[model samples]
Target: MQSSYNFWLVGISFVVATLASYTALDLTGRIYLLASARLRHAWRLGGAAALGVGIWSMHFIAMLAFSLPIPLGYDFATTAYSLGLAIGASYLALHVATHEALTAPRLLAGGTLMGVGIAAMHYTGMAAMQMTPGIDYRPSWFAVSLVIAIGASTAALWLAHTLSNDDARNVLRKRLIAALVMGVAISGMHYAGMAAADFPVGALCGAAKGVNAEWLATSVILFTFAILIVTLMLSRFDARTTFLVGAVSNLNGQIVRLATLDTLTGLPNRATLTERIERAIHSSRRQRSLFAILFMDLDGFKTINDSLGHSVGDEVLSAFAQRLLLCVRSSDTVARLGGDEFVVLSENLGSREDAGALAQGVLDRMRSGMWTDSQPLQVMPSIGIALYPYDGDTVEILLKNADAAMYEAKRAGRSTYRFFERSMSEAATRTLQIQNALHDALAAGHFTLHFQPKFHGNGNSLAGAEALIRLHHPQLGTLTPLEFIPIAERSGQIVQIGYWVVRETCRQIRRWIEQGLPSMKVAVNLSPRQLLQPNLVATMLQIVTDAGVQCEQIMFEITETVAMHDAPRTIEMIREFQASGFEIAIDDFGTGYSSLAYLQRFRVKQLKIDRFFTNGLDEHGAEGSAIVSAIIALAHSLEMDVVAEGVETESQLDMLRSMMCDEMQGFLLGKPLSADDFSEMLRGRMLTT
Candidate 1:
């Protein structure tokens, strides 16, 4: 009788197994097709649970409907043993298969393997079930039983695929987690059906079939070995993969930082500067606000860098940049254009003063920095500020005007700021015009030299004549140096102009010397811009050598303001010139800082006091006399000669003579003249006087 019952169980199990296998194949294929590409990795867990639960439930329900003689006593140990083995083996298979690369062929082969495993587990579990007398639980009709088992497993699999394909999968960390939940649900349903099928009355009311000692013991051993192997594989995969991903991410961040940031100052570099400037311009136009661009340059920076090492220079620059940040409003943008050059774009300005005040604030703060390790370095920031929509609408014009103004500030005096002047703007336009005209001017030989005579006070004989610059405009008639000097300086044509001055001056001086005229020193004014050249001293010395003139015969005059602006550097240059056997004179002395010390610091052969001091002599009265006497005494103390400029009256000349001023230059002697008139004066003066 027991054997007959077992045969019936097997017979029903065969039909159920076929159904479970067919269901697994159909559902697995649907899940494979419908699940997201992203969640396809989770199929192993879902497929395993479906196959196991489908097989377990199919067999149990088939046994229940058959009314086969099952165990009368509780067979909890047998059923639990089978369930534990099926679940454990199915999980192991799914986990192991998931780790393999899931190619198209592998997925097909895996699904086929899963389908076959389900069929085998169902048939084998059915064969393991024992038939005994007096078991009350029985399966319902076959159609209803098949539907309950197969329909549930199919629904759970379909739901997982739906979650995988939709946005729901994004909520879970990995598709594998969602797969695990579905797996557990499917596993529980299958086990619940198993409990319903053939448990004793007390066991049926319990949560699950109670595990016997033998079943628990077997599960513990098998699960322990399976977990150990799985853990080992996971650890190795995690270590190598995590490290490689982390390394690649770190390297990418470093590369991005290098591309955007400056290496030296660690500021956003030129590439960033261009992008930001464009954006600022666009925003300004959209917002309808005024923006000011300030171009800043460190005055006399090259002197520090040349004398001191770059390390010290770099320290000074870094310190200066920090101070600059503190001076401006947070809204303003500051950037290092490169080297000692920096720029500031001040936006959202309510008034011109807002921009001006910000620029002035930056200058004040930059001046206050302790630049040198030895002493507090006083560096005047020469800033050029141009307002938006007023000075220029475009970034290029604003930047250009700001730069031009900065150069003008340097020319006026170091450590000062200047707004873009209309004249300067006009001057730039004139320069461009002149630059164009100069190419033709040089080719047409339109440049000429003029001379102004300087006489010895006591003898009234020719001491020397200064060579002046002249440009003959075809339409505008003759132009003076005042008209063209600025243009030449701006166009960087001063190098050519300076060379012409020396050559022409020497030529005139030599002609007079050949004509038996008195040998006298010819004074030539050298522009400060020309003197700042790195090779200026060398170039001048070469000029003197090439001209075949005695170095003493040609006097190179520089402005007192410029010399005092960079005293140490200028002193070094003056010493080089003096060493070359040339006479150095401080021109426009009184217009600058107290020139009383000029004779001592500078090896100046002559001092040309400015016209303003001379013009104010009568009005100042006794103070003027005292000042003139003091200047003459100061010049004599250092063994230097003094010249009074703008001596327009006999009284002015008389006062200068009484003060023992060695020479006088003004309208009193003669105005600057053509070279022919100057030569005639030299010739006529020697004959008459």
Candidate 2:
């Protein structure tokens, strides 16, 4: 018997097959991109069902297209069993195709299994016809048919692997082309298998409960299209959903970095540090161990910014942060608490000395120096360590104790580390009290200026006087600079207090000149904080101008340490002061390291020998006067005059005279007296040298 084909039905079969192939490619991409295992497994099962039905519909439809001399039908049970076989084959194919690594061996094995299943399903569907004298198979044609089916499955596997990427650009066009090739292969295998079978003449239908071919084809095609459409839509939706999830995760990471990191150094900021400290406390308590919170400040950082500008200062801070990271353990946390202050949280520390060693290591690194613009800069560190569960059990208390200890280190000449002591807390309390009292004193008009007369070294005439600040507290009584000066400097109260002294000195000078008293130059002590203040010369000039005193009538005295703190900046400020018609005096000389070069560069008018040398001068009369003589000669050689401080003894005065010092300021001739009392002495000539 001769068989014919329905071209329209055959075309529809190819369409269904192509759609299934494209859907298979889409589902592979969706499953591959999913990060959730459960989601991926769900898609895999659903995709298998969709692809299985599509392949089955195409096979059944193609079979229906083949007409014969006898009526065509399929047994219901056999038809259902063939559908199950098609589904099983599709499930295995998807599993192999969407695997992360579709190696050659894997593709070949999966292709063979799927090919065998398709062949069995076709043979099983053919058996659904249940003819009395079953159709016979031609061995050669059947072999060709099996070869075609296996080859089609392998090609489909390769195509699916190549094109199953998530990129949507031109994916549809590429997949459609790929699907056409795949559909043609699937159809070819089916038709070839059908051609291998020969129907005998007068074959009789055997199954009574078989389904009609038209109705089966129609139902399968419609069902297959619906599944394919929904699967493709779900694939697109899942891709977009996962991409959005990844974007949100990236955004959250950025936000966390911003909130917890320093803007300049990229180190953890105070908030992050606080959190870590709390965590460390919990962990250490559990382990019955200790950790340390080191509070550190860079000494003289203000001068660095002032002299080199903030840009270089920022570079220094960043480099300092990197160095801190290098010195600490990976488990430790180093954070910036703003400005030059840094806090290091070292956990699981074995002992207090271990923390001390860590701090000393940091100090040594800083001493080695850092470079910028091909020049090495000197930035020193002062660290204070507060041990957990000892210095403080809470974050606030620990930080407070550490800060107090740090200031003590700074006060102890800086460039060192200090452990927190119970006494430091008391000192901190007193400091707070003094700060409050200072505000009260400034507001309540309790501060006064006392004048100490300095006499010309060779004559009994008043040369100049040093203006000293005196504070008369309600309970502390009259207090000298030694009492509260350091507190003022540390609290930044010196800036304001220094201004008051400046203004009051100018006023006193004007008073002396107006009262027909000697209008000699008066020396005003300048603090390091005052020297670092911007526009200081201009500000003092304005104060002097307002007070109706010449700038020449006021002398500014800075210590040797202040001069050398930032030598370049100090020199520049001194020049500015001198240019504005003010003279600079190196007060308390020999108390700090003063190179000859820096001294010469100072261009000051005089050097005030410190009381240490002056008081010791007459002890041996010659050897005791050696440093005094050298300083006097150095001053003379530099065209600068010399003044002796704290010269109370007549022998000390005699030694200063022999050294040819330009001036002397001590109680030997006159002690510090109230403004009015000093005025009376100026008129009475009681301060005779």
Candidate 3:
């Protein structure tokens, strides 16, 4: 028996096979992305049915293209049974390809199993064509067909697994390419099976009346394509639905973030902070352990925001929030409580001192911090702490008290922390009183400078004088810096006060020069706020130039703490002062922890021993004398002069002289004097000279 092929119908079979393969690949991909097992299983079953029919139809079409000399027809029952085999094989293939973990062993076993199913379905379909002289299949050709079927099935399954989850357009192109390969392979298997069949010259087909081969192929082709096209349409709809579901999920996540996080810093917002604090309070009560709530406000943050724009301020706040996160344990919560305010909830603290230590750690970072580029801003926080079970048991009470303590810190002088005290609320009134009086005092000539004379440690020769700020209150008499400086600084009036001090220092020096007294430098204190002023160097230089006072007539004194706090910015400012021929001095030195490296980096000409260290120099050959002697030696080695302040005794003066200290200032030498008194003293000394 012999068969001739209609090449066109054969090509049509290949096209049907490619269509089925492509649909299987696409559907498999869609099914895997689904979150629900039921949805995946349903789509898998439907896809299997469509692909099975399509495959069966492709085989029938290929067989129709091969016309035997004798008539051929398929048994309805056997053919229906073959269809069931195709569907079952397809379901198994889909399941294996879509398995969650397609490891090596799993893929091998799954491919082999699907291969066997494909071989069974192919042989079973072949058996449906019953002939009077039953078809004899050649052993070699039969084995070859069986091998081709199994190999094709295995390769197709592997391709399905590999290509199904790829969602990109390139993946779709790859899938189309894969479909062509699998279609050719399946066609090869079918043709090889057809080649294996041997028919006698007189053989008669038993199922010749059952179904005409060409008609069956045509009918099934139409049916299979209909099923595949509809299945593809459904898959498209399902994919769209899945995409919408994913979008909704993302929207929900964003909504949750907006509710819980600060819009600016992405830190927990006030509500989230409150929730965490409440939870902590509950846990703390259960454990009978203490926690702490720290409330912090940026010192002078408003000045930066107003002067540099909110954009810069926002960046500073965000950076500070990140720094706060770094300062805490992962278990601790840091949150922003609106503008310039933040909160930290520290759990399992050992004592109030531990909380204080935590606050100090944050302060240290701020003290050493510069927040942006192109004129970096120095940010220091005034922190207030309220301990759990001591300050308050409830969240509201704790937060309230912490805020109150923060205000107290602002009063005590910003850039420091304060524990909640019963007396803090009352101190607020006094602080307010001082702040109110400061506005008029500068305008009314109540703000005055008192000059304290510095003498040579080795002799009574004058070295210089430090201009101390004093406010003459009509009702309360003269008040020192300790009484009102903090208030003025917080109110940002210190910048104006600083300018006034410079002008007055220059004026007084000019008067002394004109009065025939020898020219001497007078040191004036610079607040950090004043340093933050734009064009500070030029402004001070202009003031001095306008006063007819030489640059050498003024020295700027900065406390060692403030100078080293923001060292990079301070070093820059000092360079400008030095370049302008104004000498810089470190006031209250030895009080701050300035490393020798930093001290050398600064271009200061003098180091003013803080009163604390100066007071220590009472007895010679004592620890005080040794420390003073070491400091004087250290200053001299650095090519810098030392000024010992608060020298109130003859013994301290004598000790300072023995230590080779360069300058001394105290009541024993001369007290801080009014401008007139200092002038009279200067004139008398000039007369004596």
Candidate 4:
């Protein structure tokens, strides 16, 4: 049967062929240029399949509408096999060309192979057609087909040469223009090949000899040349754009690295810790898994830092962090919080016991020795554990509870672990309240000074009164020294309390002077820790100057322990105080390690014999007397006056007087009295006795 054709059929065929070629070019370009990950991967195998199918489809479709001079029967298997082989050859050429310099010459070679394969398929399908009613399909002359293939391949190579120049590939916008030009060229080729398949019988079949063929071929040539020009101007543009994108991605990765990691230890820093903890908390809530919040603080880290330099300290911390990380499971998170502090957020915990076990493992690892050049760092970590849901439901509560438990471990003694406890909260709250109350008490005039008079042994004359600090608790009538001394020492409020006592003592001495009660000496006790301060002399000078009283009028009393510590400084201070006209007394003499050498080092005005010696002085009729006499004899030999303390009875006093004690003080003189009661006792004693 002879095939018939119409103008509409040619136009429709031209349109269909052009669209098919354009789609093939676009898909082919994008597969290498901008395909998705999966598509890019599949392109290794599916790419060749796609190219072969595109050639076969275009060839068959062109043949369907044709009447050729040389008719050829359709050979589906041979055609597909031929197309697949050609496609594979073209791909191999492209791959080889990519390994060499991407120059115009290389592009021409690769592009020529692709063009020959595509053109041969189109022309062969066009030539294998019947031209008359009696004609059947026939194969085209192989030599003639080969000549056509060479001519088309050369033309395509020249076109590729124009498009693959360095300048052309550098500009992205120009490369897009190149892609558009190549699209139009391929489209024009489709239409021209269609026209070549069905040239009129009387008309010359070659495009040079007929209006229809010549017009279509000329249009194809013009389109191809236009594509070549556009492509040549934009090739480098596309390459440069791709390179810039890769550079930007590399820089972004570097920036993220610097921001997330600790430079010293190579661990995740606090910034990363916050992010990881938030994510872990969110995931744990979803998974219904418990996470342990562990706080690790290095014991004696400050001593290491201070003694060996921060550089060595940094090295130690880095090494220790590495060891710490090794002890935990990969599922757990470890990060440095700063300086010798680290934190671990362990998730997927089966129970509190699991967390404890993990914590114990970390502690054991940390406790191992860290060998250094200067010293082997024997570091022990104080671990604080706060379990999820039990200790806290939120990050803030968990961190707070963990911190509280960490301090508990520190207080229990460093290098241990402590789970959070509820009682700590109550105790912390109460301690805060008491601290504020102490500050207010200093302002409110709630503290007072009282005195216990000591009588001289010879004339029973009042030699001095020992100034005692007393606080009147609202609940308990009058609280003595036992109730508040400890609280003062711990809170460091003793400095302020000591200041109050000095001021009150001076004020009372002035009151006694005004009342004509006697201008005798008064001794105020000083705590050992407070007296060791470098600024003690300055503080004393200021307090005495502020009181506007003679320093000699207010004698300074120091315990045996205070007098012994830093003997040289104590001696220097004693000389300074004496130069400023203040008497220095050694209190609680026998209770401490008393040395006559300390007496020679310090210019002590008096030694207050401890209450134990005085109490036992009357214990045995002979033995007690002997003991008291020996102590008084030792005091006399040292050239220091003696004041016997705890003189509770007439017999105790009688024994002290017999031993030649210089003075005596205790409950017998009267229990430490309030200022008003003491004033009354002074008035009665001076007026009647």
The C-alpha RMSD in Å for every predicted model, in order, reads 14.9, 6.8, 8.3, 14.8
On TM-score, the candidate that comes out on top is: 2
lDDT at 142, model 3: 83
lDDT of 1: 0.64
- Candidate 3 yields a Cα-based lDDT of 0.85
Evaluate residue 287 in candidate 3 and report its C-alpha lDDT on the 0 to 100 scale: 93
Runs in model 3 deviating more than 4 A are 70-81, 102-113, 123-130, 162-164, 167-174, 204-223, 247-251, 254-270, 279-390, 400-522, 527-550, 561-576, 590-603, 613-644, 647-689
lDDT accuracy of residue 138 in candidate 4: 28
Against the true structure, whose lDDT is highest? 2
Name the regions of candidate 1 deviating beyond 4 angstroms: 1-271, 300-315, 329-331, 348-357, 367-380, 389-391, 401-424, 431-447, 471-496, 515-518, 527-542, 562-580, 594-598, 601-603, 686-689
Which is better, 2 or 3, measured by TM-score? 2
Residue-pair clashes, model 1: 5
User: In candidate 2, what are the lDDT values of residues 413-459, reduced to their tens digit?
Assistant: 99999999999999888777777888778889989999999999997
Residues 391-485 of candidate 3 have per-residue lDDT tens digits of: 88777888888888999898788999999986764565567677878989878999889999999878999988989989888876878899899
Q: Report the poorest 10 consecutive residues by lDDT, candidate 4.
A: 129-138
TM accuracy, model 2: 0.68
My TM-score estimates for the predictions, one after another, are 0.56, 0.68, 0.67, 0.46
User: How big is the positional error of residue 578 in model 1, measured in Å on the Cα after superposition?
Assistant: 4.8
lDDT of 4 at 664: 86
Give the clashing pairs for model 3.
none
- Candidate 4: residue 76 lDDT (0-100): 40
The order by descending TM-score is 2, 3, 1, 4
